[model samples]
Target: MAAVIDERPHYRPARGIHPLHAVLLAATIPLFLGGLLSDYAYYSTFDIQWSNFAAWLIAGGMVFTGLAVLSSLIDLARARGRRKQALLTFVLLLVTFALGLVNSFVHARDAYGSMPDGLILSVIVTVAAILATWVGFSSLRVGVTP
Candidate 1:
């Protein structure tokens, strides 16, 4: 038996997003989810403090979402083969940020009045965050796996 060496070039696609963008984008999910849980707590317990927690969490989520949006825009412009996926991820992050802004405003109202609507917005924002994260990550891969 003769020893033989097989030579095959491995193909690796460029990363779809920068590491900082990924970190910022990943941060939004937990923050928004926290906001949602806080909203639910407020809704269930009717406590004003939970609204405050939700507001702060939403604000934090917005901060990260905004950063992610900017980074994604840069990624979109830089991307070559993955432009469409990058654009979709950017749009999703933008939508999440916008909804989070609205949710923050809703949470700013009187604790009692903010309910239902605030909770509703929280749900929407959380779902958007999840979808954005999913789409962003799912689109990162280039080829079929064995």
Candidate 2:
């Protein structure tokens, strides 16, 4: 009897970050930065009325991105096994979301009027956004196997 040998490549489905998550991650940094700039202009320049429009628009975008991040985080948490990178990404996303909420509220309500405190919140949101983008994209390369 001759021994049989199998010669076939094992097939495995490719898994990675979801496209919606990628889109939201890509959008977060720019929106946060734009919000920061708009807030700066609104607070710094005394006669700039148009800055308020830009600020509000950016704030709305941030809130939308925050919701997307939360959705992605819930998906990550539901996955089986230990996903350290994904968990880290989720934490970063949470931070970004929280900061985004605060920033949006401040911008929408024009809280603190023209005071520089709003600018401070904008700066924090920008930093959190930057970190979230960095972690979220880096985790994409790691890939998740479902």
Candidate 3:
């Protein structure tokens, strides 16, 4: 038997996963934390409704972000091929942000003048989502496999 070496350079980062995963972790943690803070703020502020669409979207996005980041970790267990995990994370991240994209257009007119909070929250979460996703993309495994 002959020892065969990988002909192609592995997608290993010279710096390691810290650059991507850490940054993503950093971006999303805030939305999750802010959800709690915002809830407190709303509760303290009078005449604020908690069960509205904006509340759900923001709170849900934060939770989703936290879950996805926790789930899609690239480590020694599946380090050889973590592309699938990467893909799943990408999809969830998209879904998390798509909510924002939808709200942006829907809140444009604001006929009732009911404070387009969903739109604002959506914008913030979407930006973080997009940035985190991009960082993940950079850390993704490229090239073909047999």
What TM-score fits each model? 0.87, 0.74, 0.38
Model 1 alpha-carbon miss at residue 12, Å: 5.4
Show model 2 residue runs off by greater than 4 Å: 1-14, 48-51, 78-82, 110-114, 142-146
How do the residues 25-97 of candidate 3 rate in per-residue lDDT, one tens digit apiece?
4556455335435544544453345324445545555555655555454432354455554565556565655
Best by TM-score: 1
- Report the Cα lDDT for candidate 3: 0.50
Q: Candidate 2's C-alpha lDDT?
A: 0.67
- Looking at candidate 1, the ten consecutive residues that score lowest on lDDT are 1-10
Question: Which of 1 and 2 is ahead in lDDT?
Answer: 1
What is candidate 2's lDDT per residue for 33-135, written digit by digit as tens? 7777777777766545635764665666676577766866776777454377778777877877777776666665653463575678778877877787677
> Which candidate should be chosen as best, given lDDT against the real structure?
1
Worst 10 residues of 3 by lDDT: 1-10
RMSD of each: 4.5, 6.0, 10.2
Assess candidate 1 and give its TM-score to the true structure: 0.87
Give the per-residue lDDT of model 1 (tens digit) for 20-128: 8779989999999999999999999998888899999999999999998988888888877677888899999999999999888888898688889999999999999
**Model 3, which residues run further than 4 Å from truth?**
1-18, 47-80, 103-146
Better of 1 and 3 by lDDT: 1
Ranking by TM-score: 1, 2, 3
Q: What residue pairs clash in candidate 3, if any at all?
A: none
